[model samples]
Target: MITAAPHTTPGVLDGIVVADFSRVLAGPYATMMLADMGATVIKVESPTGDDTRAWQPPVREDMATYFLSVNRNKHAIALDLRDDDDLDTAHKLLAKADVFIENWKPGGLAKFGMDPEAVAERYPELVHASITGFGTTGGAHLPGYDLLAQAASGLMDITGEPESSGQKAGVAIFDVVTGLHATVGILGALQERQRSGKGQHIAVNLMSSALSGLVNQTSAYVAGGVVPTRMGNDHPSLAPYGPFAAADQPLILGVGNDRQFRQLTTALGASELADDERYATNPARNAHRDELRATLETYLQHRPASEWVEEFRELGIPCSEVFSIAQGVEFADEIGLAPVQLTGAEKVPTVKHPIDYSRSQVAYDKAPPTLNEDRQSILEWLDAEEG
Candidate 1:
């Protein structure tokens, strides 16, 4: 099991060192983002490796795709943190790290002497980011999982049809979003550390991230007292903003404003529909959504979704044909988004980091690591003095 950092590009986070003690989705995803940007991330796994290592049925090269998706660009080692010698190694890594991340249960790291207060006291300049299922208080005892966060955050309740059972999203969306949040928080803290000359504790939890990620749905309740329910694919506040049937399949029409609505109507060869008093404004369109949908379907039914997608797009109306994950990737490639890249020994497929920095770009230097593969190198590095 070899882990080699590719030498093709420069990274923005080139000098930063991260001591990663996270497993599963949220924490690993965040650290991976850091690694992509040039942080030297040491992923400290347990004796058996991260739990996602066994999450199979979707294995590539006998490796769980789940684990592969988020663990790239890092050096990995397995250690029994409970052992005195192994715990000392972890402490040595932390002493040199500019950032430290973990997703263990609240209070779980205290027994190993890695608690927030202790770490801060030991290494005052180390930025410590903690990911939990819940925060460190009332909900601390409850284990965090993506499904539980979705349920507790009211996301599931507003996901499906009003009459149907609440449905979780097709992916672990909240966990992913939480991971992004954690990345943002870590970066911000690092920026501030430049001036403060001290590190701070950053905490992110699945439930809170779910609520924040809900955005408009949560806003309707908190700001307007509206307890929004599932409208299926239809948006709660916008009309002609969901999937609509075509001659052969469903195409999504996202008329964000009256101008887009007019374009859509003109593209459908039904310009008069856009001028109707009942559908002139966004508010009016929402009020008359059912009628508007029916009128659009009449025109959309004349062509397949692909044809309509082209015509509507040419007219500057926001529209697209529904696609599977593979198709979505193909479309991205077709449009020059370059959504994926191959890295490391197996030439594994990895999704590109979402942002494109012109001057200091993200680098796909290392592929996802194998268990204890970099143990000797990382231990030797950590044992050295400050540059």
Candidate 2:
């Protein structure tokens, strides 16, 4: 575990409070980001705890790493909302909170009187953000898992090789993307609230976030009248932009434009290739990608990937030898990015939040809590507020 420089300054979001009733990935991830920015996030779980508490096997001590990954810098209290006392506690928490977030199924929280409509009516000054698998309209009944969103949103359709079946991303990408979208929406609403002195409902769903996150791929079909298909690692538009065989291992080349192409060919001692009409311009190079790949490999075959990576980088060509996750972390550290932080009393290792600010710092003062670990303190605080 790597330790980052300690931040002594107050957080940018020091006074903001968030009531987080989200379980699993999307909602918790968003709340975690808020917590990192110094929001006092209270994670309200069910009596059984968050679902990720049981998603173990990759464990640190008795805790699930998956749960730990996104629950730090927050206090936790498990509340059985079915009971009147616990439901009242939840309501109290919301009364003091600036933001409320949940990922319950559409109408799932209505029975508890915690749905968006009810919350909006009750606490008009509190920003309420909802994350769902699908929208609350026609697709509300569909389960909101990342895999299902990937399948439904054309991500799976365009992933993998031309002949093989589509593959889900190694991680729950849509869930993370949806969380980021929720975070942005919540922040935007909070800013708007400063002006209007009233908060609004912010809704984000996995399927919509997935389609938007697809960016250029979806733009092709929607704007350019082209439906893209699977091409393995190769880009649909950019040529000479995928992994190529070096003498020992594969090297990824991201030669995006004519200049990079020229730099790449010249570095390989194949300067004449830059003059070839079929491989000169981006459009022409994309049209002759296969031939260009074959010709590039003929020159690349003389050197190992590592050697080519060094030379191409010096020549201002975008290239890299593939790295495993471990190596990736090491590389980040090597470049002076302290990628991990040992947080809280137990010194649990956590991947640090990726942003850097000049005035305020990201918080890593608390570790992810055990189930309902903060119940006594939270309850005392709530009772004291009532008193």
The worst-scoring run of ten residues by lDDT in candidate 2 lies at: 1-10
Q: Model 2: per-residue lDDT, tens digit, 1-387?
A: 111122356677777889999999999999989988888889999989999999997999989999999999888899999999999999999998899999999999999989988999999999999999989999999999999999999999898989988988989999999999999999999999999999999999999999999999999999999999999999998989999999999999998899999999889998999999999999999899899999999999999999999988888899998999899899899889999989888899999897898989898888999999889988887777678
Q: Local error of candidate 2 at 258, Å?
A: 0.5
Cα deviation at 152, candidate 2, in Å, is 0.5
lDDT of 1 by residue, 293-368 (tens): 9988988899999999998888888889999999999999999999998877768999988888988868776788
lDDT of each prediction vs. the true structure?
0.89, 0.91
The prediction achieving the highest lDDT against the true structure is 2
Instruction: Give candidate 2's error at residue 309 in angstroms.
Output: 0.8
Candidate 1 pairs with clashing backbones = 6-365
Worst 10 residues of 1 by lDDT: 1-10
The list of candidate 1 runs beyond 4 A from truth reads 1-8
